[model samples]
Target: MSRQHLASALILLAISVALLGALQLALVLPGSDVPAVLALFTIAACVYAAAGIFAWWRRPTNAMGMLITLGGFALLIAGLGNATVAPLEIVGAVFSTAIFAVIVHLLLAFPSGRLDSPSAAATVIGGYVVALPLQLPFVFASADSREFAVASTTQRIAGAAIMISAAAILTNRLVRAQPRTRRILLPLYSYGVIAVLAVPATSLVFTTLGVRGGVAMPVIQLIVLTGVPLAFTAGVLSGSFARTGEIIQLSEWLGASDSRRGPLTAALAHTLGDSSVQLAFRLDKSDSYVDEHGTPVKLHSDTRHRGQVAITTNEREIAVIGYDTQLTARDEDVRRAGQVVAIAIDRTRLANELIAAQRDVVASRARLVDAADQERFRIAQNLHDGIQVQLVLLALEAQQLANASDTPRNVSTRATELRKRIDAAAGDLRRLVHDVVPLALLQRGLVAAVEDLVDRMPIPTDLVTEHENPALTSTVENTAYFVIAEALANTVKHSGATSASVRIDSNPERVFLEVKDNGRGGAVAGKRGLGGLADRVDALGGHFSIDSVPANGTRLIVELPCG
Candidate 1:
C-alpha cells in the first residue's frame, strides 16, 4: 500500500476497534440509552471508513480521492451514531473524536497542494494544525446545555474549516497540474457524492421509524453494505484509470490543434467531421506557428506553439500533428494511441526527403553521363577529321611514288604495305567514332539509324517497325540505338544466333523498342551485356525487361517516356 493509504488504513483500524469496543462496553455495562446510540454511530463510521481505506489501497495515486471518500465515511458514522439506538456516551465520543483526528492527520500527510512549492506546503500544513486541535472540544463537551453549545459550535467550525481548506488545496493541486488526473478522477467525484448522501438518507428513514436513539446507526450500516461492494468493484476495474487519463490528454490536444493551412488544408477543409483522418508532418519551424487568431509569436518563446502533443526526440522537440476528421474526445480507442501522430509525421518527412534526394542524384548523374558522351564524340570527330585524312593523303602519295619509280620489287612492296596500313588505321578510327556516338543516329533518327546498323552487320538481320518515328532528341536516339547495337553485338559474339529482328514502334505516351534473336537463348540481363544498356534506359525513367528461357531465344523490350 502507498504511505498515504497505509496511514489511512491504520487510522481506520484504530477507529473500528475503539468504536466496536465502546459499543460492547456501553451496551453491556448498563449505561443510559444514549451511550448505546453512540456505539451504533461508531459502528456505522467504521464501515464507511473501511470502504475508503479499501479504495485507497487499490489506487494510491489518488490521495485526495481517498481523502474525500474517507471524509464522507466519517460524516456517515457520526451522523448515524447521533440518530441511532446505540449512541456513544462521553467516553465513547472522545475515542471517536480522537479517531477522527487521526484521519485528519492522514489527510494532511499527503504531499498534495504544491509539493515543490514551500508556500503551498505551509498553507496545507497550517490548516491542519489549526483544525486538528478543535476535535478536543467536541470530544470533551459537558452534558450541560451551554457547554454543549460551545462544544457543538467548536466541532462544527473545526469540521467545516478542515474540509473546506483541504478541498481548496486539492483544487489548487489539480489546476496547476496537467488535465489527465481530472478526467481519471471524475468518476470518483460522482461516486463520492452519491455515497455521502446515502448515509443521511438512511438516517432520515430510520428516524421516521421512531427509533429511541438518533437515526445515525442503521443509516451507517446501510451505507457500508452498499459502499464496500461498490468500492471493491471500482478497485477491480481501476486499470481503466490509466486509459481515462489518456482521454483527458486527447481533449487537451484537440483544444490546442492548429492546422489552418497546408496541402492538406483545402482537402481537409470540408472533410473536418466525418472522414478517415490522415496525419502528415512538415519540418515546420517557422518563427511562430499561426493560430486561429491569425496572429504570430516567436514559437520558441511560447509554450502554446509547442504543439498539442510535443515530445523531445533525439534531443529535438517535435509535435504530433493530428489529422483525423472524425477524431474527437468521445472516441475511446484514440485514448490509448500513444504518440502515434508524432511518429507518423516523422516517417512522412523522412520518406519525402529520401524521394527528393533520389531524384536529384539521378538527374545529376544523367547530366554527367551526357557531358562525358559529348566529350567522346568530340575526340572521335577530331581523329576522323585530322589523322584519317592525313593517312589517306600519305597512302595516295606512296601509290604515286610506286607508279613513277623503277626500283621494281622495293617500291611495289612499299606501296602495298602503305595501302594496308592506311586501310587498317581508317577501319580502327571508324569503329572508335561509332563507339563514341553513332553518327547515323545523330543525323537520321531511330528507325533509319537502326536499319543502317542492321545492314552493316555480317549476319542476316531484319529491321521491323509498325510506325516509323521522326528524329528524336539526340539523347533518346543514342540510348535506343546503342541498346539495339549491344544486343546484336552479343548475338554475333556469343548467341550463335542465325537470325535477329529489331522492332520499333511509338505513339504519344512513350516509344517502344524490342530486339529478338533466334539464338541459343540464355541471355540474362545482368549477366550478359544487356545490364549496362538496361541501366542506360532506366536512367531515362523508362522500363527495360529481358525474357529468356534456357532453350528459347531472348526478347529484350524497352520503353522510354515520350517527352
Candidate 2:
C-alpha cells in the first residue's frame, strides 16, 4: 500500500477501535431502552466499519471501502438521537437516517466505486439531499407538528425512490456484465440490495407479528444488515482466492504449451483478463527486449498506453509485461502477478533466446557459404584471365615451333603433342571454373543455371521449370544451386545413374527443387555432402531430404526461402 492509503487505514482502524468503547456510553445514555439495542447497533456498525476497512485496504484505489466506512460512522452518529441532551439529540437527528444515503451511493457505484452513468450519480446526490438537507427542517421543528410529519413522509418516499434507483442501477450492471465479472458480482450485490430493502422488510415483519417495539426488530435488523459487510468481505476473500487460482492455472497451462512467446503471452492475458498485455524477453545477447517473434521492442512510456511490470527471479531481470494501466492500478498487484508467473515468463524467454541464437548460427553459416562462393569466383576469374591466357600463349608458341620450315620432325611431333596437351588442360580448367561457380546461376537465375548444368552433364539430363523467378533471393539461389549440385554429384559418383531429371518451381514464399536419377542407388545423407547441405537448408528455415535405396533411384529435394 502507498503511504497515503496506509495513513487512511490507520485512522480508520483507530476510529473502529474507539467505537467499541463508545458502545458502553450508549448503554447509559437516555432512550437506550435496553442494553440489547446498543449491542445490536454497535455490532452492526462495527461490521460495516470493519468490512469497509478491509475493502479499502485491499483496494485502496477504490472508494467503496471508504464509502462503507462513512456509512458505519454515520450510523453511529445517528445513534446519538437516543440521547436526551438537546445538543446530542439534535446532532444525532441530523444524521440518523443519513446512513441510507451513503449506502445508496455505495450501491449505485457497486464494486467499481464509481457511478458509471449520470442517472446513477444524480440518484445518489438526490438521496444525500433528501436524507440530510431536506430532513434538517423536520428535525428542528416540534415532533408532532404537521410540517414535520409531511417532511417525514416526503423523506421516506424519497428514500424509497432512491433505493429503487440504486437497485435498478445494480440490475442493469449485472445484466450487462461479462460472465467472469457477473459470476463474482451476483452474490455480492444481492446481499447489498437485500440490506438496503430490509429496513422496510423488518417493519413489515413487525406489522405481521403485531408488535410495535421490542427486542425482536432490532435483533432481526442487525442480523439482516450485518450480512451486507460480511458479503463484501466474502467477495473480497473470493476475489483474492480467484487470483491465486488463476496464477496456479497459469503455471499449469504454460507447462503444456510450446513455451513460445505467443502462447505464453496469451496465457498471461487470460489469467489477468487483459487482452492487451504483451510479453517482452530480456535476451542475454541483446541490449533491449524482443517480443515473441524475436523482433526488437522498445519499452518506453510512449503514448502512456500500457504499464510495464518487470519480472525478476534470482536477481536477474527475466522479462517485462505491459498491461492496461487503468485496469491494473495497483503496481504492487502487477508485481505479484509477475512473481507468480516468473517461471513461465523465464521459460518462454529462454526458448526465444535459444531460437535467436540458432538463427544467428544459421546466419553465420550462410555468411561462410557466401564467402566460399566469392573465393571460388575469384579463383575462377584468376584461372580464366591469367593462367588460361598463359596456357593459350604457350600452345600458340608450340604451334609456331611445329610449323617452322627448319624444324625437326621429332621436335614438330613433340610440339604437336604439347599443343594437344595444353588444349586439353585448358578445356579441363574451363569445366572446373564452370563447376566452381556457374555464371548462369549467379547472373541469370536457378532455371538458367540448371539448364546449363544439364547441358554440360555427360549423361542425358531432363530439366523442368515452373513459375521460375529470375529475381530470387541470393541466399536461396546460392544454397539451392549448391544443394542441387551436391545431390547430382553424389548420384553420378555413387548411384551409377543412367539419366537424371531436375524439376525447379517457385512461389512467393520459397523455391523448390527436386533431382531424381534413374540408377542403382545407395547414397547416404550423413556420408559427406548431404549432411552439410541438410544443415544449410534448415538454417534458412527450409526443407531438405535425400532418398536412396539399393534398388531404387536416388532423389534429392530442397526448399529455400529468402526470409
Candidate 3:
C-alpha cells in the first residue's frame, strides 16, 4: 500500500474510535432508547468506513473511496449529538445535519465518485446548502429557547426537496447509462432509490402522528444507511467481475494468429463494449499515425470526446487507442486492455512488413524477365541493321570487282578495298556476338571474360580477382558479367571518368562484385540502366546498391547468391 492509502486508513480508524467512544458515552446516559440508537448508528458507521477502506485499497484513483469515507466520518460527527456533555451536544447540533448532505453526495457519485453532469452537481450543491448552512439558524434557535418551530419545519422541507431532486437525477442517469454501465450500477441505483424515499417517508410518518424520538425513527434510518454501503460494495464487485470477463474474452479472441488490423480493432471494441473505439498504429519511419488501411489519422479532442491513449511497448509508442468520453471513467480498464493488445499490434506490423518485402521481390522478378526479353530484341535489331547490311554491300562489291576484266589494275585496287570492307564486317559481327555472350566467359571463366571486356573499353580500366574463384551457377555468372559490363559502360559514357576498376571476389556461398571509378559521379540506383541492373540482381536473389556523390566518384556493389 502507498503512504496515501495508509494515511487514509489511519484516519478512518481514528473516526471509528471516536464514534465508538461517543456511542459508549451515550449508552451510559439516563435514557431508555439511548443504547439502542447509539448501537444502530455505530454499526452503520463501521460498515461504511470498512467499505470505503476496501475501495481505497483496491482502487486508489477512484473518488468513491473518499466519498464513502466522508460519509462514515459524517456519521461519526452526528453521533456526537448523543454525548452526555453539554458542550458536545452544542457542537454536534451544529454539524449533525451535514451527514444528510454527505449521503446525497455519495448517492449521486456512486461507482465513479464524480458528479458527471450539471444537474447532478447542482443537486449536490443544493443538498449541502440546505442541510448544513440553512440548518444553522434552527440549531441556534433550539439552543436559545427562541422561536424554533418554523425553522425546524423549513429545514425538513428543504431536506426533503433535495432528496427528491437527487433521486430524480440518479433515476435519469440509470435510465440513460450505456447497457454495460447500467448493468453494473443497477444494485447501487436500486438501493439509492429506496434510501431517497425513506427520508421523506419517515418525515411524513412522524409529522402525521405528531411524534418525535420514537423507536421507529432510528430503525428506519438504520435500514436506509445500511443499504447504501451494501449497495456500494455490490457495485464495486460487479464492475470488477465484468472487467475480468472482458479481458478473458479478449484474450481468447486474439489467440488466433491474425495479422490484420481490422479484426484486432473489432475485437477490442467488442470487448470494451464501446462501438466507437478506434485503433491507430504509429509508423516509426514516417513519424505519423495511420489507420488499418494505411491512411493517416489525426487525433483531436472536443467537449464531447476525450483524446487517445498511446499504447507503448518497451517504452516506445506503437499504437493509440481512442474511446468515447462516457468511457473515460473507466480509464484504468482501457489502459489494461491496451497493454494486452500492444504485443499483438507489434506482431501484426512485422507480418505486414514481411508481406510487403515479398511483393517487391515478385515485382522485381517480373521486371527482370521483361528487361531480358527487350535486350534480346535489341540485339536482333542491331544485327539486322548494322552487320547484315555491311555483309550484303561487301558481297556486291566483290561480284563487281570479279566482273570487271578490262581494267586489271583498277580491278586489283577495287578488290583490295573490298578486302578491307570484308575485314571490317567480320570485326562488327564478332563484337556483336561478344556483346550477346562472350566466348571467353563460357570457355575460360568469368575472370578471363571480364579481362577481355576491360581490354575493349575506350578508357583505362583495371581487373582484380581473388585467386580462388569458386565455380558459380551459369545464371549467377551471366548476371554478374552483365552487371559489371553495364557499370563500366555507364562510367565511360556518362561519368567523365579518367580511370575505372572492376573487382570480383567469390566464396562458397556468394560472389561479390564491385566497380569503382574516379569520375564526377551522381549515380542513382532507380535511374538510367541501373534500375534494370538492380532488377536483374534481385531476380538472381542478390543485393545491389550504388553510392555516388557529385565531385566525389561512384562505387557500385553487387552480391549474387552462388550457393
Candidate 4:
C-alpha cells in the first residue's frame, strides 16, 4: 500500500476501536436490555466503513464512498448518547435523531456519488434541517419539560415525512432510468432501499404489531439495516461483470461494423457508457494527433476530470483514448476498454496511410505522363515546321534548276538526282514525326490507329473489336496505345513469329486489349519493353500481364479504366 492507503487504514482502525468502545458503553449504560439493537448499530457502522473504504480505493473520482463513510461515523457518534457524562450525552442526543437523515442522503446519491436532481438535493437538505435543528432546541432541557417533549415529537414527525419523500423520489428516478442504467441500479433499490426505509419504520410500525419492544424488533432491524451496505457492494461487483461483457461485445461490434453503422469513436463511447469519450490518431514521426479526415486534434493533457490512455503498437504511440473521469470512475477500466479496440484503431490508421501514399504515386505518374506527351507534341511540331519545310524548299529549288532551259545536261542530271534524295529525306522525317506523336490515335482513337498500324507491319496480323469505344480520357487512351505498341515491338524483336493478332473489348468504364502472336515464345515481364509499360499502366490504375511458353504463342493483356 502507498502512504495514502496506509494512513487511511490506520485512521479507520482507530475509528473502529472507538466505535467498539462506544458500543460497549451504550450496551451497559442503557435503561433497556435491547442488546441486539445496540450491537446491530455498531456492526452496521463497521460494515458500512469497510464498504466505504473499498469504494474509495476502487472509485476515487466518485463521492459515494465519502458519503457512506460519513454515515458510518455518524452512527458511531450518535451511539455516544448512552454515556453518563453530560457533554457526551448531549453530543449523542444531538446526533441520535439525525442518523436516519444521514441514511437518506447516502441512499439518494447511490452509485454515481452525486445527487443529480433537485428533489434529491432538497430532501437531503430538508432531512438535516428537521432532524438536527429540532434536536438542538431541547438539548439542555429536562426530560419531563414541555419543550423537550414537543421538540422530540416534532423531529420524529418531520424525519418520517422526509424519509417518505426521499423514497418517492428514488422510485421516480428508478422508473425514469434507461434500461441499461436500470439494470445497474436495480440491486441497490431491491435491497438497500428496503433496508434504509425500514430503519425508522421498525421503531414506529413494529410497536403496533407488538414486535418493537420484543425479541423480533432487534433481529428485524439488524437484517434490514445491514442490507444497505451489502446492496452497494453487490452493485459494484455486478457492474464489473456487466462491464466485462460489454467490453467483449464491443470488440464483436467493431469487428462487424461498416460505413452505414458509423465510425469506431462513436462505438467506443457507446460501449464504455461514457458519452464524452474521444479518440485521435498520432501522426507518423511526430508527437501530434489527427482524426480520420487528417484534421489536427489537440490532446489536452491538462483538462480537468478527464483521463487518457495512450494506445501503442510496434513501440509507437499510434492513438490515444481520453474519457471523462467523473463519468467513468476508474482509469483502469478505460484502459481495458481501449485495449479491446486497439487493433481496430491501428488498422484504420494504416489504411489511411496506404491510401494517401497511393494517391501521391498516382499524381506523380500523371505529371510524368503529361510532361512526356507535351514534349512529344513540341518535337513533332518542330519536325513539321522547321526541318520538313526546309527540305521541301530544297527539293523545289533543285527541281526548278533541273528543269531550266539554260542548264547544262550534266547539271540537269545531277540536280534531278539531288531533288530525289531531298524528297526521300523529307519523307523519312515525316514518318519520324508520326511515330513521335501518333496524331491518328489522338484524332481517330484506338481502332483507326491500330488499323493503320497493323497494315504497315512486316508480318500478317488480325484486328478484332467488340465495342468501338465512345470516348476516353487522354491518359487512358495513351496508356492503351502504349501497351499495344510496346507489345508489338517486343514481338517483332524477340519472337520468331510469322503472324500476330490484336483484340479489343471496350465499355464506358474500362477497355480491355489483347495482343497474341504465333511464335516460338519464351517471354517474361519486367523486361526492357514490358517493364516500363507495366509502370505506365499501373500509374493509371490499370493491369498489365504477359503470358508466354516455349512452344505456345505469347500474349499480352492490358486493362485500362476509362474514367
Q: Model-by-model lDDT, in order?
A: 0.55, 0.75, 0.73, 0.75
Question: How many backbone clashes does every candidate have?
Answer: 20, 0, 0, 0
| Candidate 4 lDDT, 401-472, residue by residue in tens | 999999999999999999999999999999888877687887988788888888887899898999568578
Q: RMSD to native for every prediction?
A: 20.5, 15.8, 16.2, 19.3
Question: Ranking by TM-score, best first?
Answer: 2, 4, 3, 1
In what order do the candidates fall by lDDT, top score first? 2, 4, 3, 1
- Can you write out model 1's per-residue Cα lDDT over 1-563, one digit (the tens) per residue? 33455677667765765565465545443544555444445455555555555544433333433553554344443443343254444333434433343333333333220133454456455544443455456656566768778866766665556556555655665566556655544444334334433444566777788665554665464544345335433532354442333333343443443563233222222222213332333334532332222222223323332222333356554333343322333233331332433443344455554555566676676676577668877888888899878887887877777677575888788887887788788788777877667777777677777888899888899987974574455566677888888988888887888888998888866789988888888888774478877887788777999887767888989997654
- lDDT score, residue 360, model 1? 67
The pairs that clash in candidate 4 are none
TM-score of each: 0.42, 0.56, 0.44, 0.47
For model 2 the local lDDT of residue 453 reads 75
Residue 509, candidate 3: Cα error in Å is: 41
Q: Number of clashing pairs, model 2?
A: 0
Residue 557 Cα positional deviation in candidate 3, in Å, after optimal superposition: 36
Q: Which candidate is the best by TM-score?
A: 2
In model 1, the worst 10-residue window by lDDT is 265-274
lDDT of 2 by residue, 48-159 (tens): 8878887766555456677777777887777766666788778788986677777677767655566768999899899889878887977778889988888889888888
